[model samples]
Target: MNPFLIPRRPWTRQCMLPLGARPGLGTAAGNWQRLQEAAGGLPVPGPATLGNQPRLSGDAACCRVTPRLDRPKPLVFSAMWVWALLPILLVLWGTVGFWLVYAMAVANGSVNVTVVFPYISTCGSDPPQSCIFGQVMNVGSFLVVWISYLRFQQVRDWGCPCALNTAGLVLGLLCALGASVVANFQQNNQLETHLFGVFLAFVVGIVYFWVQAALTQQVKPRHGGGWLGPARFCLCATGTALLVAMCALHGLGLKSEAAICEWALTQSLFLLFGLFAEDFRHIESCCVRLQGRAPSPALELGAASTQTLAL
Candidate 1:
């Protein structure tokens, strides 16, 4: 027996008497007659009456059994603010790694100061700096994957096209994997594999941003899709131009200019990811539910009979 269903005390006929029915009748015959009249006056539990009664599955019944607040307050802070930190932290990590490597290389004279403008990889290729660069990129790659998945879920929850959203998620994950490759395989050691990572991070990364831009337009968030959609598109375009310019400059024997373009392109991609904060701001809460099937008619009837007997 459920403790919640138990009564505090046994019910008596006097306590249960209907309004206007005298409970103080002296004669047994008179008392029996009054009780019979009261019972006859009560409404019968017919099909129509049962249909009008609130079932255990009704909203009122559920509310009574399981209490819940209309608006649940957060314990510390909103998760959206935490989500916004991901891109910012990722950019900061990469920037710190790049500068740290460069400063170390300059101090050690590992890179030529005059002839070649050092690319990000050039700064990381040497000892000590390489270790820091690899660690930073590996961690940043995980952050990239995390941010990408969150953004994918955000769009998916907003009812975006499944195929397009799935493609975007795949592209973003691939870009992160590429970043990991670039980090592990130093250009000085494995030039070919490092270049492949560059293609995934830059080329595939640009495509992912473009897909996200499309999704931004499709969802049209409450805050305003008008600005974010166009903004994302512009960022994607700028990244694409930078990538092309970087490749073209390298091909044309302008290694210094190419290196500059590469750096600019990388920063632009980071900025693109940070733009997800605009969408994330609108998210207040997230929910997960575990449901069980309703009781069968026979079970329901049995329960009802048991409850009646208990009463």
Candidate 2:
């Protein structure tokens, strides 16, 4: 009999092979069994079959794993956080200092004429009213500065080198305090105090300007014209003119109350203008950087172009 027809040792009990079985059918069967064992004893589906299929340990079904995509990190600057707190501290100092001056003025009298100088008569003989006016002006000035600094800080995204800027701001605050002290002493008819107060005010004004210029340099350019440049020029000119007028009036021995008052008002206006200019410059610079365009030179030159027209 032929080997193909003859039963082997393990297949002796079996009478016949299944359909589609070949001469090497036993070897193929052994291979299929091994493949099933590798797949965790699960039945291997034929390529022609289609339906819900169970997952196998060594099957390609688990090969559908997806990889995660990485996102870019945000850029963070160290300087921005440092400068953020400086303005808050400055505002607090200004509030406390102004309040103290007001309290002191009230304690001395209803008004404080000693602080008003030759312009004392402008507010009448009441010293309390003059003191109150001075206090109001002081508070207003502080508010303007605080607001401007905050605007600048926001636009720059850079922190003030706390050590340098804070020192300058503190010095300016001290000078303002000194001025108040002198004014109070002078009101009490203390000539020495009056002179000291005037000196302190002058010093503070100078230091304040210096600090402003230094801080302004750090502001990166933005969109729009340089509004601050012209404004700063105007302020410097006005301030110089007022300083000259004050000195000239004093030199001529003219006790003109109006002249003194004008000098004080002009000085205050100059300071306000300077502060506004610095803030505008910072904002404009920030805008320019974000938009990636240079500010128009013609627009910058023409002051009228910078003005926001009201409807």
Candidate 3:
């Protein structure tokens, strides 16, 4: 059982060979002495002989020196994701929840989605619909609109032209606040008030994005100037076309055509935010300002010369 012990079962009888008065007895004794010496030379391995060493086998000697470690798989909602990404995701989820309630209402014949021109609040006009709509609006926009306002602040801090930046920031705040008003006041009960909120949010919201887009072009930050460059112009153009189409359809007394255009335009406005996805790095906090202008090429040359002269 022990690694150190030598096998003796096969050799037991041989080991006990008797020395007696017989022919060639002395020669046999010498042979037995030589056999005992060879047995003593056989290797006996033990733990104490080698400190925690793995026992060698066969003709090859190999060693494994290090221990292997197992690491856990990464999670979806890590700390950075929760803090920087969650607010944006929750805002989207909440907005989608509003549409989900609207769909349910349409399914039940409580409201018509396509031709009726129902305001978003109309989804929650009745008892059960109100529960889903209210939670999504109150809880979801609660994070989203404020986050929009903060993101607008980052636009300003990018060192955009003063007047333009202030205008954008104010419009963004109005958009956020107006959405809250629309959420709180049901269109069925307070139609005028809800309409007023819609005007503030929808109209001002576009202006805010326009301003943000202008800022995007003027003062570039490290994270700001990627695919967003082309996306800004495209979204603006698409939104403008949708707005014009909505107006023309409404003028022609096609209510459904106009309403669908209005809904698509709203989605286009949200898509503008997608263009600024770079701003997400600073979403939970304010915009960061770099200390000074990057040294001009001329200044860089001068500094290089100075260093050379010193050397």
Candidate 4:
């Protein structure tokens, strides 16, 4: 979620310290400015000690400290931000790019993406959508795998199961490798290898979703509801089932039906990723924040004692 939209505590008037009318001993010579401090200066007050400290003849001595009114920020490290956006961005980019290329390729009725399209890998052989298709697939698949690995660590951080996380991470990597292979070896170049890569990508992708769905359910109860849990499983199942049906139809010489099934299958897999995006978002390694813990009880007591030192 965007930090700004997370219902954070704005610098409220109630939370701010009142301006003081008296100067402290530390004020400039003869200035006696209300905002100035006395020469002796105010005693140093920690957040917790503010309420208990004796009021001194210094600026804003009666001002109270404010307590944080929001949940403590997570301790995300520098490298974690990479884990957040890469996978999501790559998949979206690839999907959009592929469609753009497909539209261009089919614009003049030069190629039919529905039936004659053996697979996405062979799209490179067509005009207007050549090598770019494979490049997008390769990049997207690589990021997907990396994201899965990062998700494994993220789930672990969320106190999820180790074995399942490991399995999901590994399968995700396998899926990426398969996709990369397909991109590297197009149907015309090496049909067997291309077919194998497609098979590997789909099969491993299904298992990856299965593990990810389980891990998502183990997230802290405070986070959110398990709204996507059943949907995640169903999406994975739908993709896998479509893949099977698409293959069977293709083998039985129903090329057009197979193409539609294949297209829907890919969409289903994409939807599967989207289902758990909310669940794993908090653990993203990218752009993570490091924040201080919640103020202690003493600090709460000092809420009415800490004052704003400046306007």
Best by lDDT: 1
Stretches of candidate 4 above 4 Å error?
Answer: 1-84, 108-110, 113-118, 220-224, 284-311
- What does candidate 3's lDDT look like per residue over 61-85, in tens digits? 2111121334334433223333445
Tell me which residue pairs clash in candidate 3.
Answer: none
The candidate that wins on TM-score is 1
| TM of each candidate vs. truth | 0.67, 0.41, 0.58, 0.61
The digit string of per-residue lDDT tens for model 4 on 1-311 reads 00011112333211112243223333221232322242134232323433333344433233332336666566655543444456467658767977766776677564775557644554454655767778778887867876676677767777777888788888888998988888778777788998898887888788788777777677676243656677777787788789889889989998778877877877777777655455455553444466678799998667534432332
- The 0-to-1 C-alpha lDDT of every candidate, in the order given, reads 0.74, 0.45, 0.60, 0.63
Candidate 2 residue 10 C-alpha distance from true site, Å: 72
Q: Between the candidate structures 3 and 4, which one is better when assessed by TM-score?
A: 4
Candidates sorted by lDDT, best first:
1, 4, 3, 2
Looking at model 3, residue 192 earns an lDDT score of: 92
Model with the higher lDDT, candidate 2 or 4 = 4
* Backbone clashes, each candidate: 0, 10, 0, 23
Predictions ranked by TM-score, top down? 1, 4, 3, 2
Global CA lDDT computed for model 3: 0.60
Find the 10 residues in a row with the least total lDDT in model 2: 1-10
Report the Cα lDDT for residue 214, model 2.
60
